[model samples]
Target chain A: MAVEILKENYAGKVLSMTIGVGDRAVTVGGATALPFHSFEGEVGNRPLIAYEVLDTVPEDPPASLQEELESVWDDPVKWAKYCQDEQGARAIALRLVSTDPDGQDASPESAAETVKKVLDAIDIPLVILGCFKEAKDGPVLKAAADAARGCNCLIGKAQEENYKTIAAAATANGHKLIAFSNLDFNLAKQINILLSQADFDINNIVTDPTASALGYGLEYTYSVIERIRAAGLMQNDAMMQPPMFLDLSSVVWKVKEVKASEEDLPEWGDRTERAVHWEAATATSLLMAGAEIMVMTSPRAIQTVEKTIDQLMA
Target chain B: MLLIGERINVITKAQRAAMEARDPKPIQEIAKAQVEAGATMLDINIGPAEDDGPQLMDWIVKTVQEVVQVPLCLDTTNLDAIRAGLKAHNNEWGKPMINSTSGETVRLNTFMPVAAEFQCDIIGLCLSGSGLPADANERCAIAVDIMGKAAEVGLPIENIHLDPLVLMLNGNQEQAMHCINAVEMFQTLNDPPMKTVVGLSNIANTAPMEMKGILTAVFYKMLVDAGLSGAIIDTLEKDFMEVVRTGDPASVYPAEHVEKTMKVMRGEIMYAHSFLEV
Candidate 1:
């Protein structure tokens, strides 16, 4: 199929970037053409997948993912290092889950330690996520952002309430920001506008329109993302123009269908294979719907999704 | 100044009949003609009818979007219709504008979410449940309230266009002056400047026939002087609209001098002058 060159002016232009001290570099912009339409226009770079590594062990990761990270799950730096050094991940996303108020309530210092260790161990780009608890994660993300200063990492889950402080930290430290809004295009545009008003360079902003698992409102998420992309490319709305990031791993890992044992549902296939396919399928769906960056957990799923992207690009 | 075409409404009998028949071809023609006549947006108002409002609105929105590239302001009192219109034409190039709502807490609570849900701009009226204020300060307060509600909903202030309720001048002679002051006050009070508009003909409503020309000219000048960005008026009247487009010069005497030099272009006026000379 011939690709439609959607945005001729902005095609292939890296959104923006900041030079890291050593190898912890990141490029935020690059859309030579629409997502996965490489035949018509230049898709300068393939979509980058960040391997998800959490501060604490995931309560119930799928067996496939758990087995792969077993040797390094105890140490975040080792885990991040293994994903990059061995697994060929383009980026590493460290989820600061400990900062959740209901969870371990980890301090900013701990989050910062994990960030520093990951940045030191791997030269690839870094994406530092918060625990989704605005109050607790706000300060924790700020500390991590400060610790990773000058590395030009992407820090967020910077929601509506706490975006001001998080955006300020990223702007001050020369890093990118992830503006997350619930599954609504208006909220996404509104947050982006608010952040831009606060003097954050829009080029450094990435939108996260909150994804859902395959059987759980995935169609709604797809429509919202597609609308956002259409508004950006067709309407030329600056607020909705940022490349999107779909946090696929979190959405897939938490679902019952992905985590349940095969014996629990006799008709279902192998639990490990089913879960990995679930993550891969969800990530692939998002890619088709214009997700520029995706974060996933299972190594096998990442490989499968990457191969699919390659075929689509070809 | 953006001229939002306001012809497509169910309030008029003709429009209601057209909608009842589900004949959007006439609506599409009206929209096309309005765009040709320089309408920046087509304000679609499908009022409360016995028929399904949302379904009708959806049909109109889709038909209009399919025909024209210009955007449509989904104007309706029915929230369901607004939602349907938004859903049907989700990916249009222009951001649709929600016709209006007063700053009353009830209205804001109801409409702000819809505006946020559809990612469209909205027109805010400078009046509340207490009713339209008589003075500028109170009107500005209402504008501020509406803007505050929009901000609370995380909608940018720029997305709001404030309508400083344009009251007629026939009954109250000082109404036009008060409306002008209200517009100025609202402009000064808004943080991220908002576009101000008024229904141009509203100021002349119920005025004497001979008084309409004078009233429209004076009100147009006053509103323009007070920084009105747009007005809803009949754009078909080329002469009146030309005067408006030309900024309503202080003296037509000097305009006559310029018009005579460009006589061939000024067909009717020049022909009348030639007849008088003959």
Candidate 2:
């Protein structure tokens, strides 16, 4: 089957962003073409994957992941260190999950402490995320941003509700911010615009157009990220040019396909292997759709994605 | 809508006094006010000052720039004044606007090179060697000629704005529709559509002062729907400007049917431009 290659000549380049300060600092974006259409324009930095670490310990981890993290699962700092060193992760994302008002309601001070310890342990860049609660996330993320100061870490989840405080914190501390908006590409651009309107530098902002898990409306996220990349590259739309973050773990983990037991359906293969493959598949799809940074939890999936990236760059 | 505020002109009796005194205060005040109300460019017309045109214009440019950094439209009949104004412009905000040139062969050599040299945005009038053509097709023929001359000077075609001059409805009803026709015709002359602009207030020139608002609202809506891109408008006229704002959501959208219909019906917003307020 002979298929003609359709190429697009785009007018703009995505904003090149570098997170972290020194040798381990990673750079993403600066691509002028569609994600991997190197046949036409340019794709500068390769996509990066960051391992997830929670401020509060997880109540339950799958047996496959549990056995690997037996020593560090209870402590975010040690878990972050383990991912950076032993797991050979590229970056570590510190999720302030306990800061949700409905959850453990962890103090901002404790989250800050967790951030400091984790920053100290990892040589790779750090990504500090917050609970979905807008009001609670601002103080918690602001504390985390302050703690990770000078590490050149990425701090955010700056939704419309809390972008001002988070933007202020990021600017004051000299860190990168992640502007989050529900899957609409325009909303993502609008939130970034609002942040810039408040005098925040757009170059330091990353967009999160809301990720979706594999087999669970992933196409929506896939299309939006593709549109965002096209808008930035083809329309010269500066508002949409910020590097995108497709945080993959939470959304991919909670889905049924990644959790269903093999015993329930004998024709299906091993459940653990299926879940890891699911993570790898979803991450790669988004990466190809123009996500520059992603967060995931599995070591095996990281290997799969690393191999995938090698083939893609080839 | 690409709105160019038309209030800073020296034609008005109040403005002439301020310019004559070299007072930057009132011009600054108008600049700030127009920007606040969302005028993208402020048209600076120093009317009929050929003797002191250059000196007066250079002064006004500095005066307006002192307060607001917004781009200024250099409106004048004097070529030397344009040169003086361009010299005085800082361009920190953006390119200065050449408030106009026409297809008239006699004026092209004078204005086009000035525009090309300074790379100012040029608003090209549809009037040719003989002056305002009888019909829309003739206007576009002149527009095509203007575009050719502009291209010869290496000015990007996109920067050219074509104003197919508006005529008063009271004297010639045929030319009223003809003006709107020219706007539509001019837009089709290029791939990216040459921008259509109009001195919006001129269409109501002979209208009774009380009726100017209604006349402008009705015809301005027609020109806008016919593909007017920019307008030299009084941003101070809130109702008329609002009508321009909501006239067409955008080109991809058909001219807003309901609002256009309402303005024609003389609905609630129709009185929005009435003389009672003035």
Comparing only chain B with the true structure, the TM-scores of all models are 0.83, 0.86
Best by DockQ: 1
For all predicted structures, in order, the TM-scores are: 0.53, 0.56
How many clashes in each candidate?
4, 0
- Candidate 2 segments whose C-alpha is farther than 4 A from its true place: A1-7, B1-278
Interface RMSD over true interface Cα atoms for each candidate: 25.3, 17.7
Chain A TM-scores, per candidate, are: 0.91, 0.96
lDDT of 1 by residue, A119-170 (tens): 9888888899999888876798889989998888888988989999999999
Q: Alpha-carbon interface RMSD of model 1?
A: 25.3
Docking band of candidate 2:
incorrect
